[model samples]
Every structure is written in C-alpha cells, then in structure tokens.
Target: MELLQALQDRRSIRKYKDTPVGREAVEHLLEAARLAPSWKNQQCWRFLVVTDAAKREKILAGFGDDNPGKKGIAAAPVTIVVCADPAESGIENGIHYYVADTAMALEHLCLAATEMGLGTCWMGLFNEDLIRKGLGIPPTFRIVGITPLGYPDQDPKPRPRKQLNEIAYFEKWGEN
Candidate 1:
C-alpha cells in the first residue's frame, strides 16, 4: 500500500478479533521497525513481542482500569513492547534522542501493520516499573511504549485533526 494511504488509514485500534496474526506478518512489521533510522545509527530500539495469554495478562497489570487500550491489549493476538537503550543513543540540548529513535521505529511498525491490514494502538500512560518487572526487561532498557497487533474488529471513522495552517508555518513560527 502507498505510504499516504497507510498514514490515512492508520488508527488507534482498540478492538480486535479472535483471529491470530501470522508469523510472517509479525516479522514484516518488525523488519520495518528495524530499518528505521536512528541517532548515528546506534539503533537504540528493541522490541519485545508478547503473544502468550498469561504474559499479556501480566503486562496488563501495569495499566490502570481506566485505560481504554487495556481491552485491546487483552484481545489482540500480539503486543509489542517498545524499548530503548538510552546509552546507545546521543543526547543534546537537554533532549534524549533514544526516545525519538524508538518512537520513529514504533511508528514505522504501526504503519506497516496498517498496510498489512492489521491493527495497532500506540499506547503509553502505564506503570512502567510494573511492566518492566512483569516483562523481565533489563534495567538498562526503558519501556517507551507498546501496541496491540491483530485484525481490527471495528471500522472507526477518522478523528479530527488541526488544519495544516494551524499547525505548520511557512518560515517562522505563528506565521501560517
């Protein structure tokens, strides 16, 4: 699928079918993430693919009951934990590049999933410490975000977005 179509089609999928995601599709998504650019090619991103029901339950423990993504995490056939090794990337101007690097990779994975007719919801706002302990993640790696992967059960309409003029400028800020 074209990049723009994928971008337009991608949604924060919250409902998934009981169907299973194929291994090849999962690998394809991971490959898309692995090929993403990184700070000085440090490749700080790491993905932990969780498919076991019990393990998914363990990860779900990190999320509060109010989190809408919790149900998706429980329903999807796969949950990819996006992680990053901060030391592997650079930092400048009080900004951490590792987070940016990992986020781009996760976006790539999400787009790929969208192109493949799969669904994903980029989710944060969970208890990182609980997730780290439950998933047995190493101390050096930070859990940046996670997404549930499977066939979408619902056809949600596109959400509203700000106009380009409102968000972007020609050459200067506030000069749209």
Candidate 2:
C-alpha cells in the first residue's frame, strides 16, 4: 500500500483476531522502524517482541486496571515493547530526544503493521518499573510504549482530527 494510504488507514486497534503474526511479518515491521531517523543517528530505540504467554502475562502486569489497552494486550497474539536509552540520544532545550526518536520508530512500526494487514495500538500508561523488572530490561532503558500486534478483529472509524488551517500557519505563527 502507498504511504499515504497506510497513514490514512492506520488506527488504534484495540481488538484483534486470534490469528498469529508470522516472524517474517514482525521482522518486516521492525525493519521499517529500524530505518526511521534518529537524533544524530544514535538509534536509541530497542524493541522487545513478546510471543510467549508467560512473558505476555508479565507485560500485562505492568498495565493498570483502568488502562483500555489491557484488553488488546490480552487478546492479541503478540506484544511489542518499545524501549529507549537516554544516554544514546541527545537533550536540547530541556527536551529529550530519546522519546522523540523512539516515538517515530513506533509510528513507523504501526504504519507498517497497518500496510501489512496487521494491527497495533500504542499504549503508554503503564508502570515502568514493573515492566522493566518483569521483562528483564536494563535499568538504563525506558519503556516508551507497548503495543499488541495481530489481525484486526474490528474496523474502527477514523477519529476526528483538527483541520489543517486550524493547526497550521502560512509563514508566521497563527497566520492562515
């Protein structure tokens, strides 16, 4: 599918089929994320693909009882944890580049999943320490996000978005 089409089609998939996602497809999605640009090319991002039921349970433990993503995590055939090392990225003007870098990579992964007829939901509200401990992730790494991947069980309509004129400007800020 074209990039624009993928972008348009991508959604926060909260429901998934029992179908398993193959290794090649997972790798293909990761490759798309790997090619994403990073701060100074430090490539602070790391991905943990969890297919084991035990490991999935450990990940689920990190999520709160109220997080809507828990259902998707429990249902999807696979889960991916996105991590980033701050030391591997730069900080400027009080902004951490690691977060931005990993976020771009995660978006790439999600879009690739959409193009491949797979589903993903970028979930962030979780206990970092719990996930790190359960997943055996190094203390140096930050759990940026988690996602469930599989064949989508539901097709959700697109959510509302701000119009370009409302969010954009012609040369100067707020100049339409």
**Worst ten in a row by lDDT for model 2:** 62-71
lDDT of 2 by residue, 17-102 (tens): 99989999999999999999999999999999999999999999998879987999999999999999999999999999999999
Residue-by-residue lDDT tens digits, candidate 1, 4-104: 99999999999999899888999999999999999999999999999998899889999998999899999999999999999999999999999999999
* Candidate 1 collision pairs: none
TM-score of 1: 0.98
Q: Candidate 1: misplaced stretches above 4 Å? A: none
Judged by whole-model lDDT over C-alpha atoms, candidate 1 comes out at 0.95
Q: Report clashes for each candidate as comma-separated counts.
A: 0, 0
